[model samples]
Target: MSSNPASTPPPPNRTSGDRDATQPQETAEREINPERDHRCESRRGGTVIIEGGTVVTVDDSGTEFGEGHVVVEGDRIVAVGPGSAPAQQGPVRRIDASGCLVTPGLINTHHHLYQWATRGYAADATLFGWLTELYPVWAGIDEEITHAAASAGLARMALSGCTTAADHHYVFPRGGGDVFGAVVAAAERIGVRLHAVRGSMDRGRSHGGLPPDSVVEDLDAALAGTQEAIDRFHDPNPGAQVRVAVGPCSPFSVSTDLMRQAAELARRNGVRLHTHLAETTDEEEQCRAEYGRTPVEYADDLGWLGPDVWLAHTIHLSEEGIARLGETGTGAAHCPTSNGRLGAGIAPVRPLLDAGAPVGLGVDGVASNEAGGLGEEMHQALLTARARYGPEALSVRDALRLATRGGARCLGRDDELGSLEHGKLADIAVWRLGGIDHTGIADPVAALVLGRLPKLERLLRGGSVVVDDGRLMPVSEAELTHELDRASARIRTREVSA
Candidate 1:
């Protein structure tokens, strides 16, 4: 959209970071001026324009260096491409992104937001062992900790250049909290697009499953909660801000009956499905003994193989399993760092991608990864795939696509958030091309993937700034530390009994 520059506000690029940690909610919203919040404008006011950036629209035409900007008359991208993109010489706020590489905000396919508080505890544990150890810790969650953890995770992800994400929260301790719609509130406050999966586990140790019985849900309650979460937060509009997915934690933690029913319920409501599958060799053996088939075949038998399903960590898939994934349109959420740390095998990413299955990168959970940075997962996805095969087997661009479009598709949000194209949400991440890692690099996108992590200069959700100048512009560091410190002290004390 064109602007006269005189009436509109100049770039609010000033570093509001020290305010991020303490005023987490307000800062995350970037509501410095309440009367003029862009989101409010979308709901009640008018339009805003993002002008002049090197737009990297990851469309079928590949990357395009459209020198012009984008126009968001409301919440949608009204125009793109230099001269052809719409220009509204109207009253608007102009963000001049001259020397930045603008791509769709990174779509995090899978995440565990509350687990941010439980990272170091599960460092040396495997998939089953890891859950056995931290399941109790998660069992302690309350509304306070859940809110803190969700805000903290979203802030961290936003700072790391993620604009939209899917969080899979499965722990439901007796007195834990009302996970019901807390994730939705957090996303609204943070101003990022979110898909919060109502993750569940029904069979516990008493029933021969992995999790403690205390953390497992009654099968009926589990199914009811899944439907409730969808009814309350699963938006299906074009530019939806929130959605829900039905996730039955894993093969070992849930009963096969719950798995089959969860699939049926999700289909009934038209929501997507997610679950952890084939993450490690131990998992494979466990499933074989209990379910009588490999993870892929087992899920297929349960009607969980389709475009609506995305399984985490297909690290042990065989050749036939990979082909089945491709043919069925099922997706995989690859978590390289979590796999390596847990001693789980490297996922057969090369074979999966070659077969044309949808693949997206995930950070898994903070407890397993110990790091939640957005770009970090993309880098790991690239490295792990190449390590398993040759360089030609996977390129940096392939990994990047997994983080963006593939993630959107996995979360069933591909129509909106994945790419920087017209009629999509105005969520974009802009990184500089002049960092130490790219002082003399030639190609911009290559400078990002091959070189050191490009500095996250700015991150926008729906054309609103959340991170500016390598830090969260709204929250303060001191506040985040205080919340983290308080949480840490409690966690340390509880771990003794937990």
Candidate 2:
């Protein structure tokens, strides 16, 4: 853990496709509006206005405002109208969005934030090979290392215009410090909304599972920890920053009994359930070998398919499985980048969506998806769907939908978040389309997904500006980088080398 800068060089901080390290960090703590009235305590902070932008409201009607403004009072958006409209009757802080495309903040439905330290370790490996290589290293993670990696991941996501992310941290190695708490702490400090799933793996290689025994926990321990996380952090309030879910890794790595019990526990607590399913043909084979059923069928029998449950990387599903998922209102977290990276086939996203299933975008884990941002994932989703199916299969708007509204539905937060609408939580992202990557794009909203990703000009969560001018407001990039380097070094030296 040397403080020497050369010992661990800082990674590039790219806001978009371009590399610009010269952006000012001056607005890290700048108030939205200093002169605004604060007499109304309910407004929390006074009104802040985003003026002169093309607003892309991913609402039910696909509303788009040509030149509009969004007025925020406290944590909710009070008004959205033409930019020419006069400001409301109150002291306000105005953000000039003249050359911006303002859209609802992107949401990430699945992630493994702790994998930030081990991003490229398995770059050339397949899913199972990659997991085998990294399990030992990940098992050695302590609380401090987990915090560092999670903080870095959240900050990186925030810079890319992500306001909320659902993380699946399933590895709980013996003696590894508070894995769940570390993720929650990092998200809170980075000012991103978090859905922290207490993921578990009960069946190990000793029991014919994919994961090593060292990283697996007993069912009782997993159940107890899941409830403890919910009791301590699952907030049901509107605009809540943190919520907890129970996720027992995957069908290949968890016991059938654990899976059934986890679902029961999640339903009893009224919390959500998440896990990986049908990511690979090998997974399907394993499920068939063990349970005499497909992954989807096994999950369904265990009561894992429902509105309260969302599965990640459902790539190898059958038509029957697809119909069952859609019928049960189950959601899917589509990880296009990770799937492509690991040589996993393109997920049937188009068919899944067409089947009346909720589909959302996920970066998966940084291990498989080095780009690890919803901005990049959205573009990847577009390309992968088109690469397999025709270009007509998915639109830029469709990708944007998966990143915003679709993600909200997967996380069961559609009523409170996900769109640019009145009374919705003011989680917004402003993209500067004036950059080199976005030039000559007729539609800024379409440019966001079709063109090279635009720079994230600003990001707001709960009506508060947390990322301004493509820089994170809540955490220091330099400090996060330093800690991440230290943690990564520790894992490489102490664990990877072992």
- Give the winner by TM-score: 2
Task: Report the C-alpha lDDT of model 2 over 352-400, residue by residue, as the tens digit.
Answer: 8888888999988898988877888888998999998887678777888
lDDT of 1 by residue, 407-475 (tens): 877777777877878788878787766646665654556556676777676677776667666666556
lDDT of each: 0.74, 0.83
Q: What's the TM for model 2?
A: 0.91
RMSD of each: 8.0, 9.0
Off by over 4 Å in 2: 1-44
Model 1's TM-score against the true structure: 0.88
Q: Estimate the TM-score of every prediction.
A: 0.88, 0.91
Give me the displacement of residue 394 in model 1, in angstroms: 1.8
| Count of residue pairs whose backbone atoms collide, per candidate | 12, 0
Error of 2 at 342 (Å): 0.3
lDDT of 1 at 140: 72
